[model samples]
Target: MSTGKGPVGIITGALSGIGAATALEFARLGASLILADIETQSGDEMITKAAELGGTATVAECDVTDYAAVERLVARTTADLGRLDFLVANAGIAEQSRIASGDPARWARVVQTNLLGTMHCVRAALPVMRRQGEGHVLIVGSTSGREPYVGEPSYLASKYGVVGFAYALRMECAEYGVRATVVEPGTVDTPLTRRPPAVRALLEQMHPLAPEDVARALVFTYQQPPHVVISELVIRPLDEAVNADMPDAEPR
Candidate 1:
């Protein structure tokens, strides 16, 4: 697959961070990619960069929170690229406020984008993959899902919801020859992680996992043989303090 035009896949939130890093890694393997995001300028820029790396890529302005937009993104990929081999549901947001005093609106955004957004991408793409008799769905989750932490009520809830959804999805897609895998990563240096000052300090103090680190793991999971189903993967920095100090921190 790396020798020529590779797997046809769509990556939500492909403009930056882990999403962008993943896109470039896939490009190095010569994959055909649909860089999906709400941003157009960065999408265009990523397309150029992917082509420079010898991958065929295009941009789709998609809001994963909107099911209709997600459906259209899947449709466009199949219509324009011939088939959908994989779906990377990586679009997400982070929140750092306590539920008792936090903005409900922000909480809603976190849940909608992190959890519902993943569901939208999977729902829109799974049917196409089922018809194809082969496909992969890789969701970018977080360490927050695996354990409870302070100051990240909604974000953790959403990720935990995603972990549940991925396992159930794996069962449903098993008979259809489609695979579902959720990658949970610890702190990563990304735009999303840098949003809040407290999280930013935590990020700066430690040697957190880079976006490319998570991206490589994602590609390896997808590149596995058809029969191999890597149900779940969790990656964290070697430093135990990352978890001990800021347990609520996550990767986007």
Candidate 2:
């Protein structure tokens, strides 16, 4: 269950959704885990689940938007677990807003958590990856990030920024033997994606994907030979099509 170092993977937002799934996925693959989340109880629950798989899963408190906090997270993980190998920047926000009637404050929250948070994790994890000379980052993003989705302007923008982060960082980190990949998943069965009856019906009618589906993608990325970087993947539901007629986002 141990990598050459103690832990094999480090995942943020490890309390739920794709984050928890990825931790379990890696644990199933015999990888020790460092799972970070602000939610102590849920994070502990995740750690316990991984422990049942006979793998070590350490939980850390990380607010990815706070650079100092993120830095300390990586530093502490490395110190406790030894050499770090995999990092998943999977924390994000899901706020529904139309540009015309959007709350600027909500938009800011989305950008801060989804976009800047990814940046913070990447910045913090990159140094650990560099030292190892071999590391992989599987970023959790949304299909809206790849193309576009109506009614969620800020969410789209932030995920789009995540795509840019992975692509650009791939270029910068290639020489260091580090790989970056963005996994764009369609709607998953998570509290974040849960909705009212009408909204849930709409999403089911459109695109819907499971957390395990994205977790499979993460494991695939992990299994790849060090020579390749699986740059970007867009996973959408075959049953759904996105609407593009919605008005563009207006300035807040």
Q: Estimate each model's TM-score.
A: 0.94, 0.91
Q: lDDT of each structure?
A: 0.88, 0.80
The list of candidate 1 runs beyond 4 A from truth reads: 1-4, 242-252
Question: Over the stretch 1-252, how does candidate 1's per-residue lDDT look in tens digits?
Answer: 222458899999999999999999999888899999888787778878998988978888888889998998899888878899989999998878765678899999999999999999999999999999999999999888987767888888999999999989999999989999999999889998888777787777788999999999999999899999899999998873544635333333
Candidate 1, 252: how far from true, in Å?
Answer: 26
TM-score of 2: 0.91
Count of backbone collisions within predicted model 2: 0
**Candidate 2 C-alpha lDDT tens digits along 27-119:** 876678888887767766776888786667878887887899999988887786677788999988777767779899999989999999988
Window of ten residues with lowest summed lDDT in model 2: 243-252
